[model samples]
Target: MKSLSIQEINTILNGELVGDTSQMIDGLEQLKNAQPNQMTFIGSIKYERLWDSSKASAAIVNENIRIEPGEGRAFIKVKNADLAMAKLLEEFDPGPPQFDIDIHPTAVIHETAKIGKGVKVGANSYVGKNVVLADGVVLYPNVSIFDDTTVGPQTVIWSGTVIRERTEIGAQCIFHTNVSIGADGFGYRPSDDGRGLVKIPQIGNVIIGNLVEIGSNSCVDRGKFSSTIIGDGCKIDNLVQIGHNSVMGRFCIMAGHSGLAGSVTLGDGVMIGGSASIKDHTVIESGAVVGAGSGVMNDVAAGKTVLGYPACDSREMLKQWVALRRLAKN
Candidate 1:
């Protein structure tokens, strides 16, 4: 583990220091689990009570907090303790190991494909006709990029990920293992004879904006007509499904196993919890939150938090639950 002086940590966090400045902090830990040589933080007032018993030698705290005089513990006071802690953890992180091979010998690149400077294609990867990989893009083993696809600079597509035709991924994006982008949307119509389902062709592509991170095994389907869009800084958790023609606004978060059906529109900063499902053609306005295991069947206003099946306002759901319990007792 890397160690830093208390003074150095204060400088890194741009925080005001109180108490001892010469202590060595070797690692970061939670208040409940901190060792004497480790650093910890109190991000909320709820955790302030933990400070007295915490064994950490140094702590990061908000500037507004008042500390008793003559305490032996060291502190770095910042504007936001949570953000400061995030920066500290980032500073301590040792990033992924670099590979020696820029373009592995086993990788196949079509002659028409444009590979930019500093791009790395790992073993058994395939880049197809007219594909464009911008500078600093990295494709790990067994990855496939189909015809006419474009990936922006500094993006990393991990092993077993596939980017289908006409898909466009933006800069600094990370697609984790087994991700599938621009797959055909699930669309069907009855046959002329009314005997079986006929597949409706998915002719549109997917557009992903910059700084997006898609988790492992997630799938984003292509649109039936217009493009399916994922806006800037959206974070999609593992096993999530984004259906055809859907548009997600900037900084939206979709937790694990959450799904959006075809033509759904999610406004900026919408949060979808685990196992939440939005019906087709639904609109969720900006800053709305769908609770875990929710089934959202209609439009949700901006800044609202909805919960339960056929989700309603959270307070209403709680009241309903209370009424149901009372009736059950009778």
Candidate 2:
């Protein structure tokens, strides 16, 4: 652990310093967990009362918050304490493991595949025919890239992940373990004789944009005729399912276990909480928020917050819950 003076931390965070500027901080922790050599933060007003009792040598707080006078601890006041904490965490992060070899000899690469400079393929990985791995791409152990797939520069795909045929992943993307991209969508048509379901051939692929990070065990399905598009800077959490032909706008966030059915359109900055499900053909407008466990069957307007099953407006949902509670009490 590297120790930094309170003055150095203030300079890094562009914050105003109070108390001892020479106090040393070696790590960052939550307010309740911070030690004397560690820094903590109060990101909201709700936690302000805990500052005096906090054992941290230094604390990061919002500029607007006034701390009680004569506290022994040092404080760094920033415009946004939450964002400053994020920057500090990034500064202290020890990055992921770096591969020594450019390409492991145990890896299998098809004769027709084009491997770019500085690309690293880990042991037992398979790159199929006509695949294009751009410069600086890293494929960890047991990764499988099917025919004609293109992985852009500096992308890292971890173990057990599969990129199916014709999928296009953009630059600087991170695919965590066991992620499956471009798998066939859940599309089945009834047989002409009505005896059984016929699987619809998924002819299209998945297009993932730059700076996207897909968490472990998530699946993004291939479209029947067009691409399932994940836009720039989108962050998808673990175990999420994105159905075929769904188009997500830039920077949309989907939490763990959330799902979107076929052809759903999510506008820029839409946030879907854990376990939320959006029905097929629905449109969630920009900046809309779907609360945890919500089942969205209709279009959600821009900047709206919806909650509950068959999700309705958040305020309306609260009112309904209150009315139901009153009736039950009676």
Candidate 3:
């Protein structure tokens, strides 16, 4: 654990300090959980009231909150407490997992594969024929990259991740444990003789842009033809499912359990809340926000906020909620 005096922390945050500046903080914890030697942060007004009850030696507070620290405790007031905390977390980060080795002896790489400089392939990882791994790529144990795939520079793929044939991944991306990329999309049609179903072959690949981060156990399916694309800086949470031929614009965020049906399109900066579902071929324009548990059946215009089971405008959903409450009171 690293310890820093209150003055040192304030210098790092570029914030105003109050109370005992010499006080030492060894760790950071939540308001209710901090020890006397630890610190906490009030990122917003909701957490300000906690100052009276918290026993922490110091706190990082948002300047807008206008609250004083308790008598004996110190406070570091910053422009945005959350962002300041994020910066401080970098100082305390434990760093990467203990892979350490450049390339483990147990890994298998096909002779046709092009491995770049500084690439690290862990034990039991497999790189198939015609694959291209760029410089600084790290493949954790048990990872599998199929034929004709290209992983860009500095990308890190965790254990049990499977990147299927012909996939294209961009630079500095992070794919967490058990991620499934470029698997065949869900497509089936009625048989000509009406016996059962005929499988529609998926011949397309998955293309992911730079700086994307996908959480554990998420799946991005391949397209029917061409590419299913994820643009730069998109962050996909755990258990999220992106379907065939779907195209996501830059910086889009999809929370845990959210799903997109085949051919769905998301414009830049779209935010999909947890468990939200967008139907096939639907268009969600730029800056739209879909609330948690929403079931979007049609197109959402730019900058709109929608929510609920059959998703509608956020204001309209609130009005419906009010009407239901009145009925229940009767």
Best by TM-score: 3
Off by over 4 Å in 1: 64-72, 189-196, 328-330
Which digits, one per residue and each the tens of the lDDT, describe model 3 over residues 1-330? 788888888889999887774567888889999988888899889778778888899988888877777677898888888898888888777788876678899999999999999999999999999999999999999999999999999999999999999999999999999999999999999999999999999999999999999999999999999899999999999999999999999999999999999999999999999999999999999999999999999999999999898999999999999999999999
What lDDT is reached at residue 203 by model 2? Answer: 97
How close is every model to the real structure, measured as TM-score?
0.92, 0.94, 0.97
Cα-lDDT of candidate 3: 0.94
Candidate 3: Cα lDDT at 29: 86
Q: Estimate the lDDT of model 1.
A: 0.94
Cα RMSD for candidates in order = 2.2, 1.8, 1.2
Poorest stretch of ten by lDDT in candidate 2: 64-73
Off by over 4 Å in 2: 21-23, 69-71, 192-195
lDDT of model 2 at residue 283? 100
Instruction: Rank by TM-score, highest first.
Output: 3, 2, 1
Runs of candidate 3 exceeding 4 Å displacement: none
Assess each prediction's global lDDT (C-alpha) against the native: 0.94, 0.93, 0.94
True-structure RMSD for candidate 3: 1.2
Predicted structure 3, TM vs. truth: 0.97
